[model samples]
Target chain A: MPYVTVKMLEGRTEEQKRDLCEKVTKAVSETTGAPEENVVVFIEEMSKNHYAVAGKRFSDQ
Target chain B: MPYVTVKMLEGRTEEQKRDLCEKVTKAVSETTGAPEENVVVFIEEMSKNHYAVAGKRFSDQ
Candidate 1:
């Protein structure tokens, strides 16, 4: 399976994030024909101060 | 740069998620000394019916 990383603003329940990981793992497993366990998913939560785009901070956008 | 994917239950401002993409891109660039433009990130949203783990559906868990 392909390595996956999820970046987002933090605020979701653990259950929701966990579900995401599972689903993504399954999708990669099915699409790539790789073992589910081999698929690695990384989650990163960003704060407003840490992200920027289009010459402005994400929180400001 | 490494390929990244973010999997989560849907419901975030586009700005918030876009900021995430930028931050992660920067982080990977800084850490690996890769070109920022070379990094790729994918975002996937999951529904309750699509994800499961630990012998239970994600929504059930």
Candidate 2:
């Protein structure tokens, strides 16, 4: 079982999340040969203060 | 690239998070032979309402 997680900023609407879950499930199923129903997709939202890039937090930038 | 993510229920303090990151980074580095600096660890905190088990959200339980 492959669990796909999408991590991004916390500004997406409910509809966007639903669409993302559906699309990611389909893609993962197609590529990995897993059943669409068995493909689990997790959405993780991070705040600017908790997210960092290039050794600097997004909030700091 | 071995990117490790820890997902759990929220409410941990900053100190706990810092310790977790340090430990996870060291563990991944030792096991994967990746340098400590090269190991990236991401902590994802999920709310009870958003988390589910056996088709029932934790909040619903």
Best by lDDT: 2
lDDT of 2 by residue, A1-61 (tens): 7888888889999999999999889888999899998888888788755543322345555
Give the TM-score of each candidate.
0.49, 0.53
Worst 10 residues of 2 chain A by lDDT: A51-60
DockQ for candidate 2, please give it: 0.12
Per-residue lDDT for B1-61 in model 2, tens only? 4677678999887657666766777777788898776665567788999999999999998
**Where does model 1 exceed 4 Å of error?**
B1-3, B6-61
Candidate 1 residue B26 C-alpha distance from true site, Å: 24
Largest DockQ belongs to which candidate?
2
Docking class of 1: incorrect
Clashes of each: 2, 0
Across A18-44, the per-residue lDDT of candidate 1 in tens digits comes to 766675566555544557787788877
Candidate 2 positional error at B54, Å: 1.6
Give the 10-residue window scoring lowest on summed lDDT in candidate 1 chain B. Answer: B25-34
